[model samples]
Target chain A: MSQDSQPRKNSRFHLTVFALIAMLTAVLSVGTPAPAQAEDGTFKLGLVTFLSGGAAGPFGVPARNAAELVIEAINKGTLPAPYNSIGIAGQAIEPIIIDEAGGGTKQVGEYRNLIQRKNVDAVIGYISSGDCMAIAPVVEELETLTVFFDCGTPRIFEDNKYKYLFRTGPTSTMDNVAAARYVLDINPDLKSVSGINQNYSFGKDSWADFKGSIQTLKPSVEFKTEQFPKIYAGQYGAEVSSLMLEKAEVIHSSFWGGDMEGLVLQGAARGLFDDFTGVFTCGETGMFRLADQIAEGTILGARGPFGVYAPKSPLNDWLRKNFMARYGTPPTYPAYKMAQALMGLKAAADKAAATAGKKPTQDEIIAAFTGLEFEGPGGTVKMALGNGHQAVQDMYYGQYSNKNGKPTMTNVKRYPADCVNPPDGVTSTEWIKNGLKQASCK
Target chain B: MLKTDNTSRNLCIAFVLLLLVGLILPNWLAFLTTIALAKAMVVVGLVMLMRAGLVSFGQGLYYCLGGYTVGIAGQHLGITDAVGILFVSAFIAGCLAALLGLLLCRYREIFFAMLTLAFSMILYGVLVKTSELGSTDGFNVAKVTLLGWQPSPGQLSLVVYSLACLVAFLTAFFMHRYYQSGMGFAGEAVRENEIRVEYLGVSPQRVVFIKYVLAAMLAAVGGSITAMIAGHVDPEMAYWTTSGEFVFVALLGGTGHVVAAFIGAFLFEVIRTIAFDLAPYTWQMILGTTLLLVIFFLPKGLWSLLKAKKVGGNNV
Candidate 1:
């Protein structure tokens, strides 16, 4: 075993060479903006996120609201700095919105259009992980400066090839890890657990992370059943039947959007939560959308960058008030995430504005975004200059409680950003350095 | 009347237009349009079965199975070629579908649809429980190996899908070929009155079962083609709604021709895009309105509308 280990350590030479190349390139492009074009002049901004479909009515609408508020605030000159002056050359920004529908190549096609045809200055927003992951290739290939606000998957950070893509939300791993910590902390006496996630990447990723973390934190937990239902499959009657049969001490569910509401409503009706200590990780985000359906005792985890009222950050508080005032209802975490991401990209804009030699180029703006840290409503969130390219962000966990006749998570716990570290072999920024090579026009 | 069954032959026209779009349009539109085209492939296949006296709400299961097969084979088996992935996925789903079809074909009408749906759910259940395939966590599919060819750019994926649409058309072409032939008439006779086909000494059960298996393999091909293009796959591809979408696209096209599947699927995706973009909250209204309009006016389906050329002085 020791001899095998010795050979493997040396075989990591390939990874080391790649890392060194990345480091050198990161050093060489120290001052050069990525595109070096004047995007400050009149230009289009593409907003790609889920705005309809099963998940849209719930989680996506909130994300849409955030983008709208950001655009409106930016256009009206009301969006506070570091985003106040986020425009190219001397032109005002025009936000063109596109809704990513279904998990097929449709979203990627729209994104390719957004960058190549529309000539959008930058891209922001993704509510669904499937869309986010699918678009990752497009954005990398196109070399567009894109910021992902809500679609959080560890895969995005684990791969170093995408230099232009940046996501501010917690990864799938982070959400799972946070929820596990939240559930185990509350029910430390728990020994047996089961998982029920939507049958897709988001569900499987979260479920795997939760189980892995649960084992890491507490070694004695026995896993019972892992049930995955088809996404947007209106009924969960049979999957629920299996979960009930498991009779585990805790039920860990990663279902979201309409599927989440459908399962929760159905599970509640079947009394699945009656005896089981439920860990409904994705419940908090869609609580407002689902309203009364989520049961009180269920633990709701947030892909949140700190909640509005919980453990105050000045930026977070101010943004909360602005969002509520602008949108007329308290914004959900997705809204905040989209808003924060655009605001962060505006940091790139500001950096471009600051060093234009009279005006900044797209390259300068892109350069400013890399390794740049900005104070926003979510406190000072920093982009990962590391190869995985994900910035430092935290997640919040709250227990669901009856607040003003609706289900909301309380007893929230805050974890540090570094708590959920990404796997090695990932670093800052992956983009399509060879955009013209791909012939996006086909 | 069945001359319209030459969908593959007719697809040549759309393929030409697609080439034009590929060269002239901005990539974003081309890319989105390509996806819409790819989706149209399955919608075409599903519409064929629906017209033949079956409506499956289990298309998503097969779709998901095809996707997962490609995903699992590529990730686990280290096969990355798009063509290889599609072959592996289609073969796996086709074999399983044939097995499942054997059991499901015994039932008639809703029973058949329900049984297929139940089987799809079983696959969905398996995908979720088995963490080795990442369960609900989707796996990232790298470049698709298409018969030793790789589609790297989103455009390449689009082009590959365009070819897949061709493949789907050819399958439908053959299905139409079968439909126009003696066996198709026999199947129709069975559809009209199964007791007569049974009385004729040719077992209706075997014919329908074989037809079911054949139709499933076609859908599996469509699904595999899509997974290769999407670069990721989830079990949701096999969900009930996924299956229902096939019925929706088929019916929307109204089985006027196999080509209607392409048109219906394309229109569904395009209308969906419009609906979501314009009213997002009420995009279903577009779907409802289109369904209402088509059912009311173009009762034969969308092909008739496209075929309705204004003849003024012949070619004025």
Candidate 2:
């Protein structure tokens, strides 16, 4: 090559490389905010939920929809009763929605991004128990006020104490306790009970809690079989056969999301539900999608008094009406949990502002949230456990029945929070084993 | 003399550029880059295996082992020092690879791939059932310390980022040299014709076993750093999809150059973040389309673009 040509080519290559670097730097700068600017009086909130993947269908999508509708209602000052205000403490709510489909580690990084890069004043969302556990410490380390909406693992608070993190819904133990109670209350001749749960923390803990509660409630109720299938295992042929072989009079499952739907479909196809009265702890989330497949007389629990079992009140009526009108279906348990979390945040923020005469800081908001009581769609949610870091709420369970070709719960029984939830300082296992003597059921 | 001088100068230039990035980039970008670079270490290991005509569909087994080692060491064993945890994790991963390599080197192609995948799935199953380690909920990794000095939360990110840069540069430098070594060439020879390598008085299986062990160590480093940065570890690290991602990045960057893995991981992260932001509902579709386009236009991978330009070729 000629010398002059070589120099010209080198210059062109240098220009191209420089341009590429400049372009990448510019693109990256888009995700990074330009430092913390003066607050514009808007309450920036980061709302995370699964937007894609298996969990999104039953849990994440409904939660996202509820956040959208509720935020819009709050900003417009159209919510009924205590929530009838323009945003929290008169500040407009600006939400930045993030997908939580990624694993726990990714969720931790996203949580940091929400606080450090996006400058969200408060953050709420996590349906995966793993994500909640992973994020709890990081939230405390970052000193960011955060609320875990629907992850049911009790270990988040049981294992570690967090100053700025709270779960706005009851733990998984409550659902299991109420499920066992409902079964024993109705089935006087109940003898053998079998269980099929996803082989995960939530499922294992729930099964253990249910078995402990049942063993305490009836000593002669023989345990037949227990199967822990992998989470999101799309088929249940073998699991169904095992349940049939065991001849369990009642089968208990804490499956949720697509896994629950898959089990219902496959079990019904095999006539597994015919001989066994299946009791599902998280059946409400999939009821709308699996209406036809859910056999009549199959018991269902909402994890709380949510969806069809929601209390009769104007606030709940408005939530149900607005959510149904927008999403073309009534809000389910996941949506109710999301709504409850946001409503609790609103109450805390409003009270803190009123007390301080200004928008409260993260610590101030957390202080107000501790022992905070608010009326949720499901009824009253009290931060009555975990040193007020955890919520204890009443739960409902009922049998599924087809009413006018749509699935609805019949003979629903609402168990008081004090009846199901373990008392302060007592683990669910210990409480159940001790026959719940310390529990206040009134 | 000139070739050695050029290598030194390039290394200096790259180090300076990374230092500048660490200084200038925002915290979130720095965090993302650190993670991508850490993950690139594993992709580089995959590329090494690919050079030997071996594809591990279960590299996550080593990766997850590394992460869980760091976690369990810190949480249960009271080993909170970053360097100590990383060392223990790498040692554990290397030992496992050494034992597994004996049997694994006996197979090739699909059998090797399936065996690796099966191993990772076994780890996943074990982790899912082990409730003491938080079961599927997984456990949080405690804050890391350097020697006896513990950085506060604000300073932790910067410290981790700097460490990631230093580790990545050193690994890449050694890897570049290893590519031209006798054992490295023997790997390619075994890949091309195992009988010919055996006839050359070099045991092909031995070379493969050494490469497998080395890859496991590199992947462990990647996993350890990732756990430190994220401050959490779960069975998902050992899931088949995570290993698939490593393979994707390795192929995306090509096994031609050592630096390609870093570039590929960086580009992947940037593309994925932007896609998720722009189309949260269809980000996976966008990612798939990008991969398809890359395969259609630049089948040799993204690194081939730089190589083709350097050679002034019309390969595209």
Candidate 3:
């Protein structure tokens, strides 16, 4: 080898790496330009959801799956109402997808790249409540329309009233309040209530909101011994031992994914559920992943604006089978919620194209989406412009029961969006200052 | 400057050109490069420790400690000045290390590593249980108080990047000086032969412990810088895995030279991005393979490999 030729080789390598980087940057820049090109059929709907990682995306994964199934079903002309033969205006809605399965600063940048550079018409994403709370402001500034599926952090919507943002799933306030009401419904005289939850905003807020509702609803039930465990981390043996020792009649937890599954398995192993009634705030996976170890008699609450296994409706069944067929799993509510976000965009586009007599503008889509409630497999769901771009939707509670050796929500009941959620006119900042609002679903 | 490998120094100049490419590279690259710089800070400190006969698995403890202190001090104590916070963080780690070093100074070899690890685990346990501090969820920092003027309103990215350059410059400056000092000589000697170092009238335990404290302080500065840039810090920063990452970066850079840390940092940032794009799900596999290859073939680190090629030798 000629040593004199080496500088040229290094230069060539560096040049190639530079050129490749240049090409990538050019591709990335023009790739997903928001509002740059409004060409019909060219518009991409970026549906970001967690397809991997921790139990962070249990609801979001299902929501994304359901969204995919709905898109598939709608593409096939198999959905109900204005959804049949649903081609948005004259242009068909196309999905450009990315997975935001993990949360952190890195993942947020990834979302920005998808929304800003991928040139998505909308973003329906995020399962982790913390990530959603962090990203809300950025998306608001960018105005890349996003419809969140199952990030239940109340702080997300309480602050900004972001124009381009909308939430479809229930809030943490709704989920916990509904859980408390459901428990009291079963036994009115239930006394001591203990909560063991993941120590993030969702878990802590679940206990706080549930306690607030319980204080107002079942005046006699004293909430005590609240346990906050780090989410998706460590064995819950010590936390569970403390709870078991408490002998509280009603135990509520917001642990989900592996943490939920692990705790339930351990509690069952330890006979922690021998006589006590237990409620899980997010036990809504339809037994796809967590069914094996979830102790019997424990009720799970869902942010179920899209009903979880609502009826034998052919479309729901088709969606279920379709998702199972495609993904080797039954459709969870998150999948449907994700589908709703997409369908909502396509529906808006179609409506705008009809009313404007042309392709939908950003304003037209915005107008169409405002107070625009559409009926789907799980009844009508609407998004009113709430504070910080939060969804005002129903949260449901159900007892997990075996249906043919599968976990399904039984005794489900709806707690409306405005119930326990901040008032319709309230802003996120004010809600934070006022703490959470308390209301009965009735 | 005198201790640095020339080829790596040129690669840095080349990276400066690559950074120019970033001007046109889009926000994604800028975002990623920022993270790499942040991680590199901690990695540099690890290299320093490794040179001194110390392999710290508790660097994360200092990182988390520095990060949380900056966040809390900025948000609560009104210490919004970014430079001041860094100083405060470094000072805090220095003090904590000095106190802990007194006890740790008498310990030898594996016991020192374990004791530092124990300190980190204690921090993790305490932080996890303390919900008001956001504990395991971590404190979401809104802004770094830059003196009385906070920089979040305008030029958030630029302000952070500027502070980053200053920190990098400072880290390189101080760490370079550290490696050239009599302490540096003792550290190398201590790593090579502790009994000999003991015979030379410097207790190996004391040298290693002092090195441990200094490394902890450096790691703390890095952590504070990252927390300010990212706007979040959690107990995860204190996890042993975080410590392990620094060690990996040191190994990747060959740990023999100060500039290798910078080279390792750049490669890590670039490769990690490439990995994320290519496999998104299985990036760890690529990371593992790269590490194995670097460890097995280029035992002197990437810089040493480049230097060997300059000799016109056949061996790679």
Candidate 4:
């Protein structure tokens, strides 16, 4: 090798090494945030949701949009009464949004980063049940005030007690229980029922609860055929064929997102919905997008009294109008749930400050938030279960109809909070097994 | 000869520096470093497989086995000692690998990759169906005791980080020495030409089988350390995407050196954390771009930048 060539090669090698080191240093510094101090005066709220994943389009993005819209409104003091305050406890809300595309392990790391590095005053976002269950214990360990916005798993609070964690949205129990009651309400002499739900926790738990509740309500009713296709399995050709063949009176499902849409298209094309009464416990999100496609007379729900079934109030009107103007789409149930979580957080902070006559600490907020009754765009939400850490609200189900080329809900039925949700001391499974004896419907 | 000595001395220095760094790292950085190092263990073993011309896409099988072993042992046998749990994790994963390696060694290339993936998916299916273990949600692991010394919640992360540093050092040291052995060279030869290796009186299948089992144990140990740090184990650990991530890390560092895995894994984690923070909506795109740049420019991986070329030949 020539002397000049050798020198050039050596310089190149050194330059490359320097570049790698510089890149690594830059990356490391990105992780090291400014030291935690409350003197900044701005409340840093970490918002986590599915920003980029299969769940993003229908569930996560709407929740994120709702959070942005609500936080913006609160910062401007333009919200309806009781929520027309400039941020939580007189501080401007500065959000640090994070994508919840990764699984539990990655989420735990991000959750720590939010608390230890960003020093977020509180966190409020999660749509996946797995992510919720995983982050609950971490929230307590770190002692950071967190509000789970949209995950519907009941196991989060029932399985363990948390000091710093609260789920503003009602659990999945209310969805299925209300669906069962609505099934009985619509047809008092319901004969046979079957279901097709995803095979994971949300789907399995929903199916079990629905089946158990229906059986308890009417012992003579028969279960014909149940199909549990894997979660996110878009095609349901075989399952649809089986359900059609069974000739059951009612076909219940807990499908959501793309899978739900897929089933509506496939099942509708196959005339499965026409042959049976379809009850979808989590179907309200698809009402607008699949308006023309959804079969007429199909029973739909919004997880709780959300979306189309939400009570008309000033808060609801503001959310609908502002959200439509901002995003060109009406907010769905997930959006309503996210708005509810932020409202709940603001209420707790205000209450805690009122009691202390100053800025409330984390413990003060926790104390004030427990068993708090707050008004959301979806009407009243009460933290009445899981020792006041879990929210319980009324659930609504309605029949879908295609009237004059527009989708509309007909025969809307509502189940009060106490009538569907299990009592505080009883697990949903145990409550269902006991024939829902404590249910008090007016 | 001089290059080998220099590499060995550099490994020692790096290991010591890593431990010292762990002692002073802030909690969040320490958590990131610990997870990166633990995953590096799996990548290091994967480097050995790459050297032997075999790529197992289902390394998650052992990774999941390791995590599940720690969880199951703690729940059923009441074993909270970190040392005992790690051993059980390694032992169970090694035994399963040994049994699977017999049939896996008979295949090559895509067949080998697919069969490994099949086994991993089967495990994922089983774990997902098992509701007692929390199914897709997974159960949290109890805080482990260190030889009967329980750490307070405040000190637990530090202790776990320290433990990870020591284990990582031992793993790298052992693999460094192994690479200098004849069997290690035989692995490379098997990759080059299995027929030629046979003529040299070494059975290619045996070398591959032994390496597969060792690799499985290493990956399991990595998985066990991660479970302890995260304090939770779910079926996602065994998902095919996770195994793909292992492969991605292996390539990011290359198979040139054992320490390359550590450097590569650290860079991967740092890049991901920063990218996710910077672009919440399109972080995956950033990661994809980084991988593309690495493949185009430093085809041998980021490790190649540190390796000085000899006057007459390439640096090993």
Candidate 5:
């Protein structure tokens, strides 16, 4: 308040302004990209997944583990026959792994950083449908080869086409469609059905596809109560109680990770699983982790022929052996999906490079990847949908049964990719509503 | 008059320097800078309330509203003009704030904070359930033309980055003037003692309401720009955590000067980016620890560290 302090306050105010400018300059200077890392005979790939948050343990970490295992194998030429070549296109593999815990907006920024800053040759990541949708357009804009390992929303392709984007896993539509078909084949006496899925795109799409397929498959089936609790709502006491009250003959959920574990635990405790035929479209994620808690007769799928239901193949054998040896847990569906994506990329790159007799250009890689078919640990994966940009693989379903002390799946069935997935150029919604007339089943 | 001129000249010089910086930034840094500036705009509005001793925990209501407005406009109504969308976003947010401000302005302190948060959460809940808008995943935002001049995909980042800097400059320039104006002084008086403000024939309630609505409009502008740059909008934007971030930046920068909001936001983003790269699993812990250190060492904020000396040892 005194004149002497007045001048000092004025000087301090200016000093504060100067300090702010200096700090900003310092930060921006750090962001100024260093000369892009020289291409040191290695393919720098960005692998993104939920490294933290609720999805980390069950989904993201497994996917990350698979990437590390698969990339190392690819780099060392240790994978099976078709993928025995070292690294991608003869270049040693280098991965820049990033966590995809933040929401879509943050993912968008991170995706740009991966491509523009890290200079990744290709990006394989995104388990959240929201993040996938957000990054898809940016992928095209950046014109970098990026593969979405697992995000079940069909809208990504059905909404817009991307030249640089490829999803190496079947959409949630197949998981639901396969579930409906498997349940009907196992139990033709199905009557009323209900669902309790997370209130998000993946959950909503799964339930819709399942319901539509069920209606088309058996018009006599009655619809019952449906509960969509918020995503990651760890406590499902109220939702379980509602499902119990409905007393629907069949219960379906596409919940994954902690949400799936919580729902199964709470529902089993309340005897809902005992009374209802519980079907988890993405249950393969919990097959081993929640083995003791899951009751018998619960039909579950690995989204495709993955994990316990993976078709007998050399690739599957290699992945299972190596993943189990490294992580102490069997590779789940997320792990399978990650392996499939990396293999698909490597296969395409190898093909392109072989034809060119050198490192392939991005366009050459795209040409080889589009509509290409390759064998994965799960089964033969065909880029048969989304104009050959999206993978359509055979789906497997089985009953959860505990034998002795270990949990396992029984009565496993495989639905051919074409039989379960919509044919190219057809949306899953339209394909299901029209009774899957174009479907070719043997 | 001389002091005001000096401040205006300094703002202009700073603005030009930022514009120059935007031009040279790489694509990734441009995107990050765009996001930080967009968030800084929202913090500017929060600082306005902070000056009046009112903390709004739900500024995200307007922020999300602005984002959805622009998204809906582009995806639904076919409006893609960047400038036009910004105005429409601000107007829509202002209208909503005007209606809500009537009831919200009456409350003070924690009640005011919680009420704002409740409104934002309500928007988040509604957006999550609206299947037409893509539900919880929300939907993508299309690229826009700048005054009918469309930039190529490669050039869009720089264009939007420059625009963000420009907008921030204008917001800071006007807000600095407002801070020195009668109404601005009235806000401080209300914070210091409401009775004195009322004794001066200024209705404290009316002043608070005006500040509330203006703050909402500012937040909406921030949200709209973010949606444009990120090309995506979701219910998460309205979630309490997003609002908490704006508050965190406000406290970090201090309400000492208009530029503090931006300085704080930039530092927060930089720290987060580095921490994430260094310790991907424990970045949140690093962020929390940084805030703790800031509050402990410089209670007034990072801005106070620049001050010549500590007087009276007042922490808040």
Candidate 6:
């Protein structure tokens, strides 16, 4: 009995030892500190974007590429005009890239990890409206300076107030409102209008705002039909069939990423575009991939003055040339949005440093960001709404025409920021419902 | 009786050990562990259904229900008490399960799985359409209070970690006993031969209904704690892919023991984090290859390694 018990005791002891070793290794491995900051006190920025998943093609990849190129340009002082600097306030920029392919809940955890574990000074990224909304409150709670680059939801600032959060891009209302104004500008006799958008906040809000604007702009336009398909739904056979049945004069859609590509391809195969003129609010992002398939006169809008509608300038030319050279394709709307965000950050940081006479804290940066205006690749981006926390910018929409082998926006009409964005102290919904009566269109 | 006593003693010791680890682990590790334990609770619940030869492809429905309940309670009703939110959410999920289980217990195999998937998708659709609930963005969950104490952001994370460790251990203990009980054996018996179980005067449908409700309640508890710790909830919680992950963890751990679920969840999270850090673009490929290798070598699961050693006379 003693001999049998001795073997059992030895095995139990071995098991305990093994468990202890495993726990110790796990703790030690995770406890490893982040890499040391570079010489000259680098400004550590956590850049979050979708590195994988459906959104990667149009939004995430371009945003991440722009971040990489812009940071390199700032560090090398190769950028032109207002952005020509050694770094943000003379500090080298170091970026830690994190994938945003995970859902909003996972993104919250990743946001915390980026701040607590990675020790980033600032965070700049988020393409999904869901991710932007989720991280907004957390960044406010943590008091971490963050810049949302391309999420267009108007609800982020409208729903809740955040001091440390700033969005350097136009809200969804700007895109839809501009699209409506363009339709009215070109087609004065527009009779019937229809829409198809992803069945989510970004899509739903875009459609509502567009409808509201069109009603305010041209009350005679009668509604035809509308469809709200689920986001990332690869097939649009049923939706296309329904739209064809309506036979409306104008069909507006706000699809993006792989969903947009799939919609354009599937719709083209069925000749949906041939039956009616289609206005794609986010079509510019997918033009590179769908240039051959897209119909000649299909209307297209970049969420803002992006891609082909971007204003010509030395700074814009330099950015376009460098981006095309490195990426082997011209920068899309998402890239321009990211560049605008980074440039806004640099300008804010420079102002803060100048005011404080040293490297500024998150609070100082927030102060400088409020009511800030700076030159973007497109035009000037102004923090005109949400108490100067949200950005308002010029927008453009036009018909898609094949230029040589590439698709480009033609007959482009630019709308100033004041013409599309809601005035201060007015929610987008309220503003739209009120017929945008106060909006000043040049 | 002596064996039961030993099992309880071991559970207590394990609980104490986990509590100590929760206290000492760094914030990030603690956060990761809390998430793993919360996810493990759902996987263990999935294992309960798996033992009855029922594979739910839509456990995410209950998970999201629980998460959204907590979020809504905290955001709207101002119910910030951790325990209060957890209990309320679990009760809501239980009531929903009781109603759904009556209809679900009649089906089996792929039909049952598809029904579960359909229900979850319905919830997703509703959530996406409800603009007041932030639509697809969902909403943020306010910070929670423990009893009457309000912890700082840092302390709240640690407190939540400790609570998760305690809750997970208690859940595992009860589930272990449930697995050994007569009803638990009846689940397997029915799975093996429903006709034999019926002849033995046991109602297989009744057993499955009870098991379904129990699994739903457990999953809800898991979802509530996860929402609290993450401080957010969204429609993705109800998405089919999220349900698929719970099933993957269940299969990876095996239905051998309740403890296997926790182990599997921890290892899965650790492997995923490492893979994400090492290869951001192809992390899914790495996870897929690992799962394939594990399934090839250990058909029963990673848990079988311990059982195999015990059968070979190295019992510990």
The sequence of per-residue lDDT tens digits that candidate 2 reaches over residues A1-442 is: 3344554555555664686587587655766675544277788899989998878988999999999999999899999988887888888899888888779877777787788777888999999999998888888778888999999888787777778898998999999988988999889779999999989888899899999998888989999999998887888888899999999999999998778888998999988886789998988877878888898899988888888888899989998999989989989889999999999999999999889998777678889999999999888999988789899998888999986897778888878899999887787767888897766656
Docking class of 2: acceptable
Q: How big is the positional error of residue A290 in model 6, measured in Å on the Cα after superposition?
A: 3.5
For each candidate, give the interface RMSD after superposing the true interface residues on Cα. Answer: 20.6, 3.4, 4.3, 2.2, 3.9, 4.5
> lDDT score, residue A154, model 5?
91
> What overall lDDT, based on C-alpha atoms, would model 5 receive against the true structure?
0.88
- For candidate 4, lDDT tens digit of each residue in A1-442? 5545656656767787787789778766765767655556778999999988789999989999999999998899899999887889888899999999879889999999889878888999888888887788788788899999899888888888888999999999999989999999999999999999988878888999999999999999999998999988888989998999899999999999899999999998988897788998878989999898888899999998788999999999999999999999989999999999999999999999899998888899999999999999999999999899999999889999997788999999878999999989789999998999889987
True contacts kept of each: 0.39, 0.56, 0.09, 0.55, 0.62, 0.47
Candidate 2 residues lying further than 4 Å off, grouped into runs, are: A1-23, A34-38, A403-407, B1-5, B16-25, B313-316
lDDT of 1 by residue, A166-243 (tens): 776656666777677778778888789988887666777678778877776787999999987767887989988988
Where does model 5 exceed 4 Å of error? A1-36, B1-3, B309-316
Docking class of 4: medium
lDDT, candidate 3, B1-316, per-residue tens: 4556554365456545644554554555555566667677888777777777677778888988988888789767877778888888999999998888888777656886788788887888788767677645465665765556655533565566656765675567666667777887898897798889888898877777777777778788888877776666777778786777777888888776667887787677566555555565567788899899878866767766555444434532
Q: In model 4, state the lDDT of residue B140.
A: 81
lDDT of 6 by residue, A372-442 (tens): 99898988889988889999999888898886776677888888899999897788999888888678888
TM-score of each: 0.77, 0.94, 0.84, 0.97, 0.95, 0.93
Off by over 4 Å in 4: A1-9, B1-4, B309-316
Query: Which is superior by DockQ, 3 or 4?
Result: 4
RMSD of each: 15.1, 3.1, 4.9, 2.2, 3.2, 3.4
Worst 10 residues of 5 chain B by lDDT: B307-316
User: Per-residue error at A258 for model 6, in Å?
Assistant: 3.1
Task: Please write out the lDDT profile of model 5 over residues B219-275, one tens digit for every residue.
Answer: 999999999999999999999999999999998988888888988898888778766
**In candidate 2, what are the lDDT values of residues B1-316, reduced to their tens digit?**
2255454467668977987778877777787898898889999888888999999999999999988988988899888898887788889999999999999999999999999999989999999999999888899998889999999987888888888888888888888888888998987898899999999999989999999999999899899999898888999999999999898888778788888899889888777766666676788888789788768865767787676566553322
Q: After superposition, how far is residue A375 of candidate 3 from its true place, in Å?
A: 3.8
